[model samples]
Target: MYFAKRNSEEPEIVIENTVVYACESASCNGWMRKDFASENYVCPMCGSQLIEEVRELPKIQTDFNSFK
Candidate 1:
């Protein structure tokens, strides 16, 4: 049996310790990146409080031009 090789290789994903806001409610799984979080640390999903946390997250490129 022979296997065919792919033409291109997948890009490597970069991960880093990123600060985020997590919901305090046990039933809610709402979270947002620190940089994108609003002044208020309120959970939009369940109206609960959000706490600061550090998580290993993949690096993302932001497009500021897209925002109005």
Candidate 2:
């Protein structure tokens, strides 16, 4: 896991958190980080349509420790 570092020495600054597309279907628990989402998004778990969702999550940065 390696996030593109915009600045090597500067701290990560996420002014706005990412918007993920999650399955709105009650039977599914699938979502994709918008950055990695495809053109036509669908639930990875149940193949249902997706909808915009804002989760109370901290900004995620790709790093070796995160993969671990």
Candidate 3:
């Protein structure tokens, strides 16, 4: 099997750290943090809860034809 190039440029990959925080209020909405190490970070408004940090997956873009 062989693969074909969809675009002249290769796909870009980026990794980032994020945090998932559950809303303290009844709302299910949550928040994220790019860097957990950062000492500064608070919900946009009150009533929101801070949960735990999580790893964010990098966004990948590719042509469907490549799989064929």
TM-score versus the correct structure, for each prediction: 0.80, 0.58, 0.35
lDDT of 3 at 37: 25
Ranked by lDDT from best down, the candidates are 1, 2, 3
Q: Estimate the Cα RMSD of every predicted model relative to the unseen true structure.
A: 4.3, 10.8, 11.9
RMSD of candidate 2 to true structure, Å: 10.8
C-alpha lDDT score of every prediction, in listed order:
0.92, 0.78, 0.53
lDDT (Cα, tens digit) per residue for candidate 2, span 10-62: 77566556688999899788888776788887787888999998765556667
Candidate 3, residues 1-68: lDDT per residue as tens digits?
A: 99986888886688755455544555545465443223444456664546565657664445842564
Q: How accurate locally is residue 61 in candidate 1, as Cα lDDT from 0 to 100?
A: 76
Which rank order by TM-score, best down to worst?
1, 2, 3
Instruction: Quote the positional error of residue 10 for candidate 2 in Å.
Output: 18
Stretches of model 1 off by over 4 angstroms after superposition:
1-7, 64-68
lDDT of predicted model 3: 0.53
Residue 4 shift from truth in candidate 1, angstroms? 15
Best by TM-score: 1
Worst 10 residues of 2 by lDDT: 56-65
